[model samples]
Target: MQLDEATLRIVAILFSLLIGGLLLFSWNSNRVNRELLVLGSSFGSAAVGIVLIGIASLGQSVIYLYTGVTLLFFAYGGGWQTMRIFERRPVKPWLAGLGGIFWLALSLIDPEHGPLITALAVAVVPASYTALMGFELWRGRGEYLPSRFALCMVVGLDSVLLVMRGVFIMIAASEAHRWTETQLTMTLSLLIVLVNVAVGYLMLSLIKERLETEQRAQTLIDPLTGLGNRRALHLHAERILRRQATSGQSVCVAIIDLDHFKKINDTFGHFMGDSVLRTFAERATLKLRPVDYLFRVGGEEFLCILQAAEERDAVGVMERIRRSMKSYRIGEGTEARGVTLSAGIASSRRVGYDLEDLTRAADAALYKAKRDGRNRVCVYTGDDTRLAADVEGRAWAEPRPQAGPLSGPQLT
Candidate 1:
């Protein structure tokens, strides 16, 4: 079979355009969100191939050839960042620097040898990337999930494509220094291009989906305490309330505020204060029934909604949390000591109302607890203005009244 220079040129131009478009898009995207160096590398490699084999000019190849070298360096930087994401020790960037220099030598030494070097370089880069991902997986470092798995698959596929290209190079070299049969080369190239694009799409889709899912989870969780934020808590509590209303089960709510939290912040610094709050939350959560839900409304304030057999169970839970926090250590020095939590326990029967009303009632009881004394628990039954007024008047006596996420009650 005869090789057609015209057809090969068309194929080269088409692939170059594809490569250019993707590289341009990746460059723009990297400005906004940087972790797409692999996209750029793929385009850069293909573009060099186009210049070296397609146009067949030394001047043009020099420019594109350097582009490929630069891209390899960029990918190595990306891989370093990728290593950080997995908390692994980063390899020296010079490893990639050396690889880039080697590729440059290969590209400039002889134009006739360009295609073979291009194929080998393409395989080497993706193989390195795949190796990075695989190493992380092997070490059991980071969240080794489907997204990383897909990335491995994509890089591995690129290596196979490169190897196939190398096979083409060998065939051409064996056939009396002539180009490989154009028909066979075109068909195989088309299939490889199509498969690569499809795999790229799959990897992109999986990563995007993973990112969106994580964002959603972050939205629903309290970043500091790892508890449900007010939004998530409200949604969950409302669902539980609806179920209770239908099944006629008992439910209770408790509002908890750390006593003298501001003093801890002011005295020990916000970092230490944050430590105390997080520790308190962790201890408090462990004391709750699995059916119970905890929420961090805001700084040093949390809520526990309990689906219980009766009001007594809720009171017991509140007491347990209060006691545990009183013994909980703050800071990690010779001065490390204990902190306390004040809580208000309110039941549906006591409030004789829905989850929102019960929450408000718990807040009222919390005021009474603070008014009477810090580190105590109270239950709401009647109008709480007097207790709340007294607590409000104390000023420095309370923890400066750091409000929860929701200042006033809202319907759930």
Candidate 2:
């Protein structure tokens, strides 16, 4: 059974209000998600515009019709801005309102052809906004958002439907002059109700998915140094070791300790200590290869996993980091202090692919470096019997010449 024009419009207005209210409630729970609030207002404006247009249909008031059309323009523009805000782009209120301003200006200047212009604006303006929204979602597809593609598809379909409706109205201008009372307009109103519901739910899902992903990352990230924490270390190590086991490639674990960190803390204060940690992380990250993983395992302690690397390769990386830290001066001229770091590297060739075994071997070598001298890199050489001889041999133990800045891509 076909519904009458008034009934379809009333249904559209009610559904829009319901979706708007739900979005507003979601915004109330997470005020940081301002996109939700903006989208909700867009729906609210659409609902109010539909209501005014419904009343004008009964009274034949040109002023009310113009006001309602302008509001609808603003409503669609807001929808477009919502996508921009969701993608972390700056909002342009003037651009968002440009559609509404254009409609009002055209209505005032060309009152004779107001109906034709109104129908065209209704078709073109909303389609433009929906198309823009779809494009914005498409641009952000790299972010791993689940509902993003689906929402884009929905908005694309909405734009197509709007353009089709406008074309139909243009072809049948004499019949479409009573814009709100036309059969095509009623059909569009019902389609809009469905679109509003789908878009609202999908947008909320997108926001929720992103928030959950970030919260999970927060648990594994060191906020101070912006490095992976111990939890991330274990998570990444498992995958790296499994891959190494299959490929038969060497994986080196390097346990690093900042030399005289306690002295820096005791002398300069914890604030300065924090600064030192951040600086060390930054410098070490720059010196390391992109394939390597770095993590903060404890206070003034860090771990590096070098993929497909042997003891010599691991030692080379550690030495560069050691030298980088040694050259860096903290604070100003008089107060400036130099910092050094020591790293102990153990390879899967000797320690096996087990993360714990590698960590233990690297830790032993780290203490051995500390005992021999600080600011040096040491390689794990089997048990204690071989350790002393290996240290004396200084085969791969001797420091290599300071290489130029690392050439390949650095870790993020």
Candidate 3:
């Protein structure tokens, strides 16, 4: 059965309003998230546009019809902006507002000029928005978002359908609504409403998934140095260990502590100490392999895991980092110093020593390195059982856990 324009308008209004309510509820849950606000605005504008079109269907002014169509284009433009904001791209609201202005201008000129003469010109505005949004989603499909490819297809198909409708209207020999009142037009109208509701749900899911991913990252990341925290280290190390069990590859764990950190903080202030930590974090990561993980396990301490063919290869990396730290400077000018660090290397040939055990062994070796003098690498050779026992007996022997990123530089 073919539905009339009035029926299509009513269905569109209800669907748009439902989607708008969903987005509004999402926004209400997290008012601080700007992306939710944008999504809500998009659906809300679409709902208003559908309402206006429905009113004009029941014998309102033609201005209501034109404005409704323009607002519909504006609503789609908001979808484009919503995607951009979700991807951390800049949004230009004026550019979107211009789409409505373009339609309004064409509508105003239609009375003075011939309506048919400007009909094609008026059709181009919405077509342009739909095409641009489709292209953007298509072009950026696999860049970052997990749901990008699906979005690309949805928007792309919508753009093609809208353009097809415009083509039929522009070339039609009959008067207004001649092509619009056809079976194809009704089908497209109902489909557009249904697809828009689906798109709204998909977009909301994308935003929520992206937000959850970000929240997880923040939970496991060091804000200052942008490295993994102790929690991240433990989580990833277990995964690495499981992989190592299958491959029989040696995994090396290193505990790194800055030398004379208290002196650095005392002489140069905590800011300079933080600069040293960031510098070390950058240098250490650059010097390590891509598969390796570097984490700021404590204020002035870092933990690294090397998945290598042999334990000696890991030792080589730790030594390289040690030598690199010897000449590294924290500040550029008068506040600069050749900051140094000490690291303790431990290995796990099998599953006997887990992340905690490896860390404890490395800590023991690290304490010895600090005692023997700073600015050197110490490898655990299974000969530190006495010190390991001492460390085991003292509950507070290990460094402080990373307390939600490094707030202040450690004294020692």
Candidate 4:
């Protein structure tokens, strides 16, 4: 077709309709993303709005023109609403409707400058919302999805262009570029086509990226406790070891085994056992520092990588976790039973910076705690005297705590 304003408007309408249908198809493929629905509504409304505006030009019905343009304002509102939904924010459709009302009021007051007045009045809300949402997306650049960020930039730049166009019109003492051959009108037409393609691609990219991210996370996370799995634990251990070596800071690996966990599972059923496991994971995580990493490396056993200066700090951390679990109870009322945890800490200062070595030492100490009547914190001291003294082969490691002796549940 011809490249005149009317032809360009038709092209824009076609683009909006095609994009709306395609995005709606994508949305149907995965109805979970509500933002897709809102985004589709925006494009659908844009097409309808353009059609009405075109019809109003050829006809004398002011009502048709006003309704059509109001829908256009709603279209802009829909765009802003899409962003709000995408960001997991609250939706306020009324605000955009309010802008449409303002636009309608101005159009009724002065028909000659009505279009200009309407554009200027309702533009800020979508523009501002778009820019703000883009800024939020920009802040999340660490997500490593450049298309998502680029989409934000596109929206923000479009808003700026619209705002600048308004200012230029007001300052030049000229009529708005609705009918005229101006850079603003041409730029807008170009942008409409560009934005339609960009939005479709970026929205798809964001959804796919999020899905991949969640899938990757699920592989490394424990389903029952929501703690890191054995693989994740190993990865974290290697990272922690490198950091410790560079800083000359010692690290501690603690192996925490829930006392008689299998018995609890058998007595109370696996359902109750699962609840206790979740409770323990939650409580233990709260007890540890942000730098300390905890992982559910096995059934009823958690591994902790603590950034500590000395051996004592690791023991202290385990003590805190043990005490925290003392009050943690599953089941309600009269039948509520409390759970206890046993911990074994192996310090990098003694075991060197190897994860396997640290893990072995921690497991050894944990075995000692299990032997010493469970529910106690044991630490691996450099002296192998305690393990050698376990002549009866009661436990694998030392009987005493490496840092300071803990009066465990047996003492109380």
Best by TM-score: 2
TM-score of each: 0.55, 0.89, 0.74, 0.85
lDDT of 3 by residue, 37-118 (tens): 7767877888788788677767799777777767887887787777677666788887876877776776677655434433
- Selected candidate, larger lDDT, 3 vs 4: 4
In order, the Cα lDDT scores of the candidates are 0.61, 0.83, 0.71, 0.72
Question: Model 3, residue 411: what's the lDDT?
Answer: 14
Lowest summed lDDT across 10 adjacent residues in model 1 is found at: 393-402
Candidate 2's TM-score reads 0.89
Query: Which residue pairs collide, candidate 3?
Result: none
Query: Model 4: per-residue lDDT, tens digit, 1-412?
Result: 2356577778888888888887788889989888788878788987898888788878658787788878877777777777667766788888656656777887798877765665565346446655655765666665666577778867777677656655554443345435343466556656746765676668777867877877887888788887788978766667768989999998888899988889888878999889888888777776666567778888888998888546666666677778778888766788777789888878887889999998999888888888888878887876641331322322232233322121111100
lDDT of 2 at 336: 86
Candidate 2 weakest ten by summed lDDT:
403-412
Residue 314 Cα positional deviation in candidate 2, in Å, after optimal superposition: 1.7
Q: Rank the candidates by TM-score, best first.
A: 2, 4, 3, 1
Query: Residues 174-292, candidate 2, lDDT per residue (tens digit)?
Result: 56564444577558667867986899999999999999988988888889988889988877788889998999999999999999899899988999999899888877877787678
Candidate 4 error regions (>4 Å): 119-126, 139-144, 164-184, 330-337, 383-412
Q: What is the lDDT of residue 7 in candidate 2?
A: 86
